[model samples]
Target: MTTLTGTERKNITPGLSVSIVLKKDQRSGKLTDGVVKDILTKAPNHTHGIKVRLQTGEIGRVKVIKTGIV
Candidate 1:
């Protein structure tokens, strides 16, 4: 008999470091709030507020609370 193990999966913590995209307004260029579910790809150093997945299943980019930026 051969022994088998379950497949390994990626772990997503509650407070994991992630990036979100900022929604743009017609007039203002301010960033918006969003959720961070899965990172599409690594963000550049200059990049901020990338796309993210929300707990409500809505995926979009948002300004995430980080060390420097509040």
Candidate 2:
């Protein structure tokens, strides 16, 4: 199996809500369903991959593969 290094990921500024699907699952292959909760900007990469506290208090990273959106 080949792992994706990454594509030309466009810069996603914080606060802009976006959605993406999980592209790979070690056991299930891939997950087609996903939703955008919040955009993270504190990371060094300045990428939108972070989990924010929701009303339900759930925490998870944005499962957005650059290719899955476009």
**Candidate of highest lDDT:** 1
Off by over 4 Å in 1: 1-35, 45-48, 66-70
What stretches of model 2 exceed 4 Å from their correct place? Answer: 1-41, 44-48, 65-70
Please state the error at residue 33 of candidate 1 in Å.
5.4
In candidate 2, clashing pairs total 0
Per-residue alpha-carbon lDDT of candidate 1 for residues 1-70, written as tens digits (9 for 90 to 100) = 2211111112222344433433445145454444345544344322333345555555544444433332
Clashing pairs in 2: none
RMSD of each: 13.7, 7.7
- The positional error of residue 1 in candidate 2, measured at the CA in angstroms, is 30
lDDT of 2 by residue, 1-70 (tens): 2222211124443333333323234245343323334443355442334433222333434444333343
Q: Report lDDT (Cα) of residue 65, candidate 1.
A: 43
Q: What's the C-alpha lDDT at position 54 in model 1?
A: 59
Q: Count the backbone clashes (under 3 Å) in each candidate.
A: 7, 0
